[model samples]
Target: MTSNAVSIKQIMTTEVLTVHPGDTMEQVHLVFRSSDIHHLPVVDEEGRVVGIISKSDYYSISNAFPLFRPDLRAAANDRLFKSLLVEDVMTRQVATLTPEDSISIAAGYFKENLFHAIPIVDKGGMLVGILTTFDLLNYFFNQEVFLPT
Candidate 1:
């Protein structure tokens, strides 16, 4: 079969780690480190994706306030870091692709948005899987077995 006939689900990683809106920054950091994934889909209680977070997002927060170090003790008057939350740093507007979506369509979205990964959802907008650039590349370049028609 041609590559176009192959659905994204065939190669996409179905195991996904998600963060809730109320999750703390420290928790998110731990998840990122353990999962070894830069992008995370932020979901609500209903399991619907509400936002996306990236390593860059955490970096941006760190960059904005150099004084807010984990080792540093906050003075009684200091409140800059304590008020920070995931909802404040995560990208509320997220781009998503459906599980049945063609790999070509996902490729185009990646090109247009310059995204490294995209959250895959089902028809009901529930999180299903995740598609990354590496997944597509591996599928396209890997040797496939072919039998006589």
Candidate 2:
């Protein structure tokens, strides 16, 4: 298939790791570490993308109110901020793409929204897979055949 003909479903990472709204920040951090992914689609009981969380989001909340002066040593012991919930720190307004969408379209959305990763949803709006800039990069760079005119 031509590069343009390749769809997101072909390259999207199907193993989706999600978090519930009530999950604590500390719990989410463990998920992040275990999954080895920075973004997690926050889902409701029905598996809809209610929100999204990123490492940057957690760091932003954790560092927003520093207990002490902004010192490297002081910041190392920031475990006190882990009490925050995913709902408190996650971006509720999330941008999502469908699995059938073309890779080019997904790339454009990522570029326009400045998003590193976006959650993929099915027709019912259920979380399916995740597409990242890295995935797209790998698709283009790893392919030996370039699209023909």
Candidate 3:
């Protein structure tokens, strides 16, 4: 490996918000609506990563339900969101990496799969952090030291 080869640990966000399988979509919606984050990793009580929920996943499923239509009454959307569980909409097949994994590896996955975010887990399969495409860009540009526009 190169002397300066960056690893996922160097750029991953350690503090992350998560949801559980039984949590309602309404809770997920609230998190998405209230924050600027694009992804939420789903974890069990033991902190093991089980699935993932992306903003796109939420919106895509929203459209799948008739009541979530913007034209429909707000109250209906509220009720529907409350009724659906995170397990119902979250992607069961999740890809993850460890903090020690190289950024090159993560970049390859992001490029090939077009994933916006990838959760980072420990050896025990516990959620630890998240690596996002934006984080990669930030690290890349910082390394380049772009001048003011």
C-alpha positional error of residue 26 in candidate 3 after TM-score superposition, expressed in Å: 0.7
- Model 2 earns a TM-score of 0.84
Clashing pairs in 1: none
Q: Please list the C-alpha lDDT of all candidates, in the order they appear.
A: 0.79, 0.84, 0.89
lDDT of 1 by residue, 51-141 (tens): 8888888666555655656445233113433466779888988888887778889898989999778889888788998999989988877
Please report the TM-score between candidate 3 and the true structure. Answer: 0.89
What's the best-to-worst order under lDDT?
3, 2, 1
TM-score of each: 0.82, 0.84, 0.89
lDDT of 3 by residue, 20-114 (tens): 99999999999998999999999999999999999998888666656555666566667879999999988889999999999999988999998
Listing every candidate in turn, what is its Cα RMSD in Å to the true structure after a full C-alpha superposition?
4.7, 3.7, 2.6
